[model samples]
Target chain A: MTATTPREATAPAKSTRGFLRDNALSLFFGLLFLLALGGQAAAGWADLNNRLHTDGFPPMPFGRYMTSADFAVDVAENWQSEYLQFFLYIVATIYLIQRGSSESKDPGKEGRESDEEQLIGAYAKPGSPAWARIGGWRTALYSRSLGLVMGILFLLSWLAQSIAGRAAFNADQLRQREDPVSWLSYVSSADFWNRSLQNWQSELLAVASMAILAIYLRERGSPESKPVGAPHDATGSES
Target chain B: MSNRLLAVPLCALALCAVTLSGCGAARGPQDAAVVAATHFAAAVSQHDGAAACGLLGEAPRTELEKSAGKPCAQAITGEDLPGLGRIAKVETWGEQAQVRGSSDTVFLSHLTGHWLVMAAGCTPRPGDPYDCIVTGG
Candidate 1:
């Protein structure tokens, strides 16, 4: 019988099974996202048809409803808010501290710590990313890449929400025999702010709830929560 | 593999956005709306009540008949519909449109791929729906 070395045992197996296992979390969530989106489309189409019938309009085809401004706006509004939530949480965590939350850093460990602490430039190990090892502008940009990407996605989806929202709003306006407002006018209108603020409030609330809840809660096997045996005062400790 | 998976959805979202934005800006829908508005206005001006009634949406047609206690042909001409002049502006937003003529405005809905007038002789009300002389119930 061959004895397995610690390094060999610790290293992931080079196989399809290993790949699937490694990516299981992301893959699982991706599948849920597609299924949920499909469900939303189907439900939204039916609801829209009901409204159309009530208003004496003909039922819209499924394909047409999928491509409509109403659907686009609905999807974009939620997407923008989600990205905004992640962007805010990521950037805020660097400066903000929670005394007893697993989601936060130890109170004294706040702010962008030293380059050594981050393993950048001279402090970077051999296995560190190329940008971290190389340092300079690449390192600086790479350091903020996660937050930057989230913020960019938020902005893009928010812009999309505005465009699609205006189109949907104008369609409703025409239904009521009202004039369609200009893009600038639409952006400044209550309809735009309402859609944005509603989603924003919910996302903010959920994030706030998670941050505070993690301080008192324990989920044994979850990385998001502290180990069950971990003290209630423990901060940033995951299972 | 993970990168490719991410790229696929991102590409799909981009494509969806492009398709949606394209739909909003298309000239075909605008032209169709304009044509419907023009036909309705022309029929009204010519005192061809039947032709004008035919262009109206089902609800507006039924409402006109119910309120007037007469057939759509006789009832539409009796309403205070203005003689709309040349088509001045057209705005279409997914299955609905608003067309403004030199003298009046017309609202239309695209039903089963055909533009039908929902309301005519509409005047803007401050912070309220347009006060339409003819509207769907």
Candidate 2:
């Protein structure tokens, strides 16, 4: 006789919820990004207007302030550093190891694992990615696509940061009764590097903290940490 | 498949590119500078020093008054500032702009919300910032 489990006993339910529920993490973060960005714009506008008042100038309109280079540069600078962090993390993990950290792979597996072990090409399952099944440049690209896409995004965001930063810096210079520099000059200036480095250093610190902390911490269900009862020396283990 | 995981970041990057480009498509700074210069020139031509001074950036207005040892209304109205001609060119960099007319050059600074004349009746000074009859510090 066949036996039915609790989940199987239930009829197919809300089709609409399946997509959102399955992608809850992305949706959650996406909504948070919008809220955070909106908050930034509002706060930035208010902060700018406060400075304007102190300088004996008129305050900017909300609509105009949102479109200003000041806002764009502020947003882009953070974005570039975050993308840079993810890009470095994704690429670095392939060839690096921390023996007892849950964040790192097993020490002996220091490079890209074997193709068969990765279940790609001939070893690909029926549900494998289309690119992985193609077994040529497509497969090769798919293999490194995460790092590649992240790297591309990091470059794009960094470029955006440079352009917007120059505009903002130039505006400040003009306000200070100084000459505005060219984009190339601005990028090479201490201001640009300072902004970039400050964000980068923080991200590096956070990532390092996570990698090292998870080795000794107990988080019952977080994929980032080893299982609550896991040994401190356990590596390459996730919830 | 793991391929689906890539879509989130790819979409995020696209969204970011699109959002930032929304501001990218708008180009109004140069025109705003032009308007400010034109208004200042119009005020100067009308011998309305109050209006002209009103259009002047804080530094320039204060500088003019300090140097002239007189009120802006008295000092600026009688400066013999030239009449602006048809627009020849406009160069904008960050919050600073230069509007070149057929007969004169006007420099403007965008401060806070409005553009103001930083210098008017400016001429080439050869490897230096333009020297203006009506100058701001």
Best by DockQ: 1
* Residue pair clashes in candidate 2: B60-B136
Task: TM-score for candidate 2, please give it.
Answer: 0.78
Worst 10 residues of 2 chain A by lDDT: A171-180
Q: Show model 1 residue runs off by greater than 4 Å.
A: A1-14, A237-239, B1-23
Instruction: Evaluate residue A201 in candidate 2 and report its C-alpha lDDT on the 0 to 100 scale.
Output: 99
What is candidate 1's lDDT per residue for B20-56, written digit by digit as tens? Answer: 5535458888899888888888888788998998899
The superposed Cα distance between candidate 1 and the true structure at residue A21, in angstroms, equals 1.5
lDDT assessment of candidate 2: 0.76
How would you encode candidate 2's per-residue C-alpha lDDT over B51-126 as one tens digit per residue? 9898898877888888899999788887878877999876565456777898888877777678888778777765
lDDT of 2 at A238: 32
Checking candidate 1 for backbone clashes, the offending pairs are: none
What tens digits encode model 1's per-residue C-alpha lDDT throughout A185-217?
A: 988999999999999999999999999999888
